[model samples]
Target: MTISPPLHLFEAFGVELEYMIVDAETLDVLPISDRLLHSEDDLPVSEVEHGDMAWSNELTHHVIEIKTNGPHPTLAPLATRFRNQIRQINSQLLSHNALLLPTAMHPWMNPERELHLWPYDYSPVYTAFHRVFNCNGHGWANLQSMHLNFPFADDEEFGKLHAAIRLILPLLPAIAASSPWCDGQKTGYLDSRLNSYVPNSRKVPSVTGDVIPEQAYTQEEYHRKILEPMYREIEPFDPDGLLQHEFLNARGVIARFDRNAIEIRLIDVQESPLSDIAIASLVTATLQRLVNESCTSISQQKEMEVASLRTILDQTIQDGERSVITDRNYLRQFGISEPQVTAQEVWCKLFEDSRKQISASHPDAIPSIELILKEGPLARRMLNALSEAPSIEELRTLFRSLAECLAEGRAFHGL
Candidate 1:
């Protein structure tokens, strides 16, 4: 159930990071998550929970999800707890000769052949999607992301939070596009995983609605506009009606009215927990800036109408920081005074301003933002590394190095 609404605006935060379990040396995706999680007789308990940190299964057996207990007021402790949980999972993974990989998409896993749906408590929920959507595409099978949830107290708060989030949603890929390669080859799009996610729901359009989420304000209106259609569409397949909830509706951002919060699903997982928290901090700060300024009116958001926002988002996903920001009005809305600005400039300005809103000084300034400004997003960095590698074998070696960066809680410096 949704916790009582936050007492203050932007009072708490929660994060979920998804990772791929793979063979340590060969880096092949491992579908042994069930064995790690359920083999109590042969191994220790797979699910571990300590306070706000916990481990759980995902739609695919090769993937697992880690999340905090509830929204946190500070990011440093949250990041610390998240890192400790990763170490705990890695320790257990040693017995299985597997470990979690940091990248958003596994380099060479064919989801159709390798996909293993979680068949425990929510088996039918996954089963329905598998049967209908053929849940084996890169989107369903390989894509991993960082999901950030922020709590709201009431309808007014939800309205403000929703608007602020929608305004910033389009720009997220510019800072967090880490999935550049799929199927062991460079997918031309920087965030190729999103290509699958945004379009994969064509079979269940009622659920995802273009993957960029339409404008939603209150719980009743959101249910009518988004959730009701999904419930109706999935009812024939899901007789038990478990898929009727807001979470399973599959939009880029979901409003958990029961939980009094909105969960943003568009961000890609970053290189390290620190980077992830930095991005989270930037998001919170940017949203808070909008709320503090009281820019909750729908009229103020006209500059970022869905059509223009979608264009910008798609361009960022395709081009990374190099994507040109042509919407002068949209840029101006974000306080980009310059007429000619790139996507990175808008993000940099947000990062600079939003850092002030955060309580802790851990991420005084997001290194990823600076790095993207200097080089590009993680996808571009991966692309540069691919170009430099003398051979395919060398590229594989580089990915192995990238894995090391994730394990150590360090950012990948482009070679």
Candidate 2:
């Protein structure tokens, strides 16, 4: 990982979006990301830098990640930057009869047959992971996500940011869930990527202790409580210590002390960059409110139990926006007075309250956010476009439209 100087809270943000490369006509996973990255040369590199953005390979060769080259002062300009990168990559991929597809997981891919690991730089780390836990599953090869990383200067700033992130994690899937179909059928999970993600590291349970992180705020506490245990647990399996870094701590939100940032990994990548950045804008604004203690104090936020938050996350992962929240205590943390509310209602209230901040900072994102709130997440809209038992051709049609949305930089309004 690259190291940078520490930044104050919310001073800058880093965003990474992942997409899958698929055959143009058939929409099957294509393991030619090396061709996409090294169009001009024979050697395949792990990452390539392009102006203010960079393209990188993931554990699987079909999935590629594009991220801001570094922390940007604001997120307003990133939607356009990411979209432009997507177009350039798409143009290059056309030569090979492949194009980029958006969403969290490929609907019909069989990872057992389609999985191929990147065989170039950083292969050691990927090999270590593959050796410890079998990488031939949906959890390893078929998921795409948008990582939202924000800076925290010191221990005090870390405490507040961690607490605020915990409160907001469960509600994220409600707005961003996009993996409705997997293994050629509905897995009954709106965020099936995350549903599979939780057990990916079950061989060593300490690696991803519940998905919602434990209540460790300070750096010292985090190392002792989270990182050390994870390292100890994976040590026997990894004799060479190749997988003993901070990145191994696979919680939904993790403290990246190497980069002086905390990354939120629960959001599924949407159909377009506009949708991904809009969701990020709303989440940042809401975090600001929590850190300021406008609705609840830092003490109150830290007191939230990991089990309670995990239970809510489980519900949203299965049901998305339709999930109901009967926990008044959880609702009160967000300044909601209602005794009962749908997850969508909770998001609507947060969006309205943070409208001013989002409008001022990310004005371009308003319409996309509104579309998601009104219609439902991309997953729900996708289900709306399908029959009770959708055939493979119907799934292909729906995803092809999504690819066009990615290429044209627009939201997917359902049929």
Candidate 3:
């Protein structure tokens, strides 16, 4: 395999979206990702490339990931490409009465009973994680997310980009929370995927670290402060060193030194590619403005404490747009003069500030962003489609519509 050259800040982007394969009629988890990977041939391959897009397997057999084949100069065309791939995958899955469903978590999956690890290719690594962390839970087996990765040139670029990412991390879930239900009921937290993700590696606290990354701007500082401690802590459980790489550090946003980029793992996969790409566009544009120091100086951004950010993150994970931001200091970072505001207000300001950049780079995303701002995230829209105590069939009905949204590349706007 050949490696691509490193990308400079904002030069390009790589987005990865994970979806669950489920029984078409019942919406139950179907462990058939390998079947999807091998749909074109008889061999059980782990990944299949299709020009600029590719389909790959995740840790769980019930999940499949679709990603850009490599970094692209812009995010404008990926939704259509990803939608085409989803259509093909759905067509193939028709034979098995299974199709791809989008969301950060399955509404009714009992992970303990239904979890199936991918038993091919990198089974050893999965097995190691299962052995150490017990992958048969909601965190490991029943979570899906959209990973937004952007490259940085060097120390100076990395510092600016990382600082911008840290400031925006808490607000991501407010706009992108899609995992509203788990175990056949509302989990109370809007983004249950992230709420569970924060504690997935509780055995090794250094691995997650409050779900907000430390203020380590440079590579040397990141290695010494974040990476080194995590590697040392997980070394005992992973004695053979299978899980000792940069990937092991599961902070919400992680520095991928190998790729010279940072990947934000906090956004839940939305109901459709359109919504996902729109959220990505908004995030990228906002970060662009911040990196250029349009809103605040790098010094002020770097001064944001982890505890304060984590507190906001926790609130958004639970309440999403409705979560109030009472910290005047945090509000000032984004140029908001209000003493306190809802998470949605902060996002409105960001969208207004970054409208020009979004229009220039991803004009297609404007409508979807407007829809989210007006209606709220997918999780809230889903709740609007059902009663407070919806029945199992009601849940199924709502999610089936979400699956259709994925298939048709249309955003979900309640029933």
Candidate 4:
């Protein structure tokens, strides 16, 4: 299944959004994804196709993933088609008293009891994961994310794209943190999904290089530094050699040289598909300007040290937009001069510059940019709404509001 290439930089991209199936009334995670897939009347649940949209199963039975067929030139049509699929899926699940919720983690569901693997098609790979790493852990069984795939047609494009992604990977959590609660309690980290995800894969140390990727200037370098280490580490465990490909990189941002693309895996799933598309547009447009204009280089002075970058990521995951950017050296790279700045300030400047560059061609994304600037990211909004829910009944009330906004395709304001 080869996807078509994009004509210009940032002009085209693909999206994949993961969502959880939960009971309509109690809102508990429901492992009925397989049953729901076949429950639809007109189509085969294994792989449903509607024009460019594709629906499929994931590692767990409570989760499903929806992806666009190929690179979309515009997000308007993409969001419309995606929302239509969500509506259709929700309608089908209603017969079984369940619905899909857009979130990185279920607020109160216990993954230990609810975790279920897809029994058909590629079950061997999933079985390996379950046996090797105990996939029932919080990182594997309970998290969801939004994946963006951007094309890099050649070696030059891959080099430039890889550099740009590494520079901005740490700050993504500040703008997309949606997992605030886990196991019926506050996890303290705003993007708890990522915090858990990093350590969860550490059992297989070669699989991930933590949140930010190590610098790789060429495909050969990436293959040697990132891919080879992982393959070597897993070879001893899987004598059959199941996990031998580039998919093992597992870094926050990875280069798929085979597909000639770079996949960004840092962003959490937002409340609605529109917001998710909006964030994708913002990131794509920003990277376009950075690479085309040569605004910055991957030099020593311009880059943050690996240690400092990891520390910042940890702080942002805990504090979200409120995290302070106190490193004046790093702040200068983004053109921030304040003695101290918040994560919101960094995103505000990026969005403003990106809007100017993208507005003439793709104006539909402006509202989403403005919404984040004004209302804060989805994570901040969720935290504020959760504050108002003082009791279990009130929490349910707030969640219902959020689920409704997700289903209705609207921005979620505080309850």
Candidate 5:
């Protein structure tokens, strides 16, 4: 039988919100969103919830993401629809003097009390997911994310698609990296959401298959290749975090993308659309450039490619700008055998080299690098305002201000 290509790419667009909810009393984390808001008229995330209480996202998408189900084309229109959903939700939250700050990590979250209980109900999938994925009852992620997926044609196009995937993966934290506090105190990490999701997402080893690892790989291939094998009816709460691994594995590539593009799973919920747009645009443009005929793919790259990608990504979660340098410089600073580098220089050079690489491979992609170099990472700006805040409330207020500016279409720096 002749096989036809699957709509694996066909392009999709989606948005997820990673919120850091403040408790009514401690501002630690009430962890409430549309889920806890009790009202008959509260907006609905999808038809999944229909009840007197305010329900959304089936405990994941709304609280996890603010997405629109569509077969839309082009980032422009998709952005419009995505923005509308965000605005609508913002309008609801405004009734309470509250604002949405898209970020990855939150501090002192008491997920124990903060139930994912929606108005109508959480399905079997969520019930199973929440049990473990929402472990320790201290749920921490309350931010925003954007995803885009492109269709894979044949193996060749898969290479291109995978390149886009690889290019975007390391750059994920750079795009979102909003979380800076844990348990109300600054945890010194920008994207704490990674901490939150790893329990829920990563930690799974992509299965080793019958076919040995290939010498060369593509982003699309990585997506399909590095998945954990399916096991019979795995449950969360297994003594081993392996259950969590299984859960994450079962999710697979498009599992989350039931709606949009390759989901940019790393960002925290931003306060507004402009923030989303700027980061998204930069990431999208970078990915676009990276996937061009010249950009490298994860599997089929030169030596040190994997390590460079891993180090850049792993460190960016906390201090995309600084932590990474610290991580890379761990030895050098201690006078130990090092990679012959400093962390800051490592980060600067990583992207600097990428800039040169892109410039050489595809000159058109150089502008995105220029923009980041000019603007600096969002974490720096977040840290400065936080330092100025005399109180937690003030810091929250600063967060609100940034979100508002980003929402109002202000320039990133102007905000």
Candidate 6:
């Protein structure tokens, strides 16, 4: 690694948002990157290879996620910069007349559509996978994901911080808001495309090994204990870390670092810039609180139950807000005086942290996350949009509106 990875606290916040390009008139799928990569005038290429912010890959049209090197503690400033940067990049690609869209799922785009692979390591993994699992969902088609990198103070404050991060893992599916219609009907799961990966991770052994016996990890320890094991089992060129290319999408590189931070893997792309920053701040607060605290009172016996933590993580995505036997000690870790614990209570602590962080770091911004919790996951916004207009057009419009609202100034008052 000639270029040493960026320093912590400075780790650029990364967001992976997916949306399919489509004909405005026909609502048909469009491959803008495909159009550009083989277009008339040559676009400047990234010699660093897969490092470019945008490219035509086996996956659907991906808007290369550029890390924010600027201070991004607030939604207004962050969304403004992110929107401008993305638009500028999209415009360059549009020299070929290709349009860019930010959506969880393209209404008419078929995940079953046959498309070539992106130039990513996971291609081979997913390629072998389709033979077994029917590829109705394009594992690659313009995926909708919200990737957030929460900055950490250092590696020493690990253990429960990392575990707290994972404890909330089940909430993802409930909040998931893309790729609704699969196999010609609503799969009833917002992120069925992303969820496809969950079933296959069963056989793979994670570094932390399912949180039964919590292990503290330093930066080097985490990489060795967690990352290195997967890397060793997986073939060298496979970036998605496919343990075996037979059954899983293996998707892309989703990693978590020790120190003052943890990286999140689930979430679709934001329809607009507002969704991006709003979701980012919401997630960041939980991660920060988890850093210097104990999350759940999950005992070794309870954690080692017949189902196991991994099993819980698997089921929780769709079920949302899963709770096992949690007690008083865990609540006290985060300064919660309440002697009992529930999924919603823990969530309240997380939301409270967001309020504090916003008040201190970003006083003017209203917490968009508050809305997500009160109303529902971003999925509700998408569902309502689709339901009201009751057409594919209406669904996409609602999706975009909810996304833009993440940054609306009206929502940004003294929150």
TM-score of each: 0.92, 0.98, 0.98, 0.93, 0.66, 0.67
* Whole-model lDDT per candidate: 0.77, 0.95, 0.92, 0.78, 0.44, 0.47
lDDT tens digits by residue: candidate 3, 1-415: 9976667898999999999999999999999898878745578888999999999999999999999998888899989988999999999999999999999999989989999999998899999999999988999999999999999989999999999999999999889999888888888999999888888999999999988999999999999999999999999899899999998889999999988989999999998899999999999988988888886899899999999999999999999999999998889888988899999999999999989878888899999999999899999999888999888999998888889899999999875
Report the Cα lDDT for residue 249, model 6: 20
Model 4 agreement with the true structure over 345-390: per-residue lDDT tens digits = 8889888777776587657768877887676777777777766334
Off by over 4 Å in 2: 1-5, 39-41
Q: How close is candidate 5 to the true structure, as a TM-score?
A: 0.66
Give per-residue CA lDDT, model 1, range 200-278, as digits (tens).
Answer: 8787777777666677778787888788878888788777766667667677788988778789999898777767887
Which residues of candidate 4, in runs, are more than 4 Å off? 1-8, 36-46, 298-305, 388-391
Stretch of 10 with least lDDT, candidate 5: 207-216
User: In candidate 2, residue 359 scores what lDDT?
Assistant: 92
Per-residue alpha-carbon lDDT of candidate 2 for residues 1-415, written as tens digits (9 for 90 to 100): 9965679999999999999999999999999999866635667888899998999999999989999998989999999999999999999998999999999999999999999999888889999999999999999899999999999999999999999999999999999999999988988999999999999999999999999999999999999989999999999999999999998988999999988899999999999999999999999999999999999899999999999999999999999999999888899999999898999999999999999989998999999999999999999999999996799999999999999999999999976
Clashing pairs in 1: 2-259, 52-69
- lDDT tens per residue, model 5, 2-44: 9643444435434433443343233344434554344467644
Q: What lDDT tens digits, residue by residue, belong to model 6 across residues 201-302?
A: 434434224422233345676556555665565444345545332122242222344224455656666556565566666555555555434343423212
State, as a TM-score between 0 and 1, how close model 4 is to the true structure: 0.93
Sort by lDDT, top down from the best: 2, 3, 4, 1, 6, 5
Better of 1 and 2 by TM-score: 2
Q: Candidate 1 at 298: error in angstroms?
A: 5.7
- Tell me how far the alpha carbon of residue 218 in candidate 2 is from the true structure, in angstroms, after superposition: 0.5
RMSD of each: 2.7, 1.7, 1.5, 2.6, 7.8, 6.5
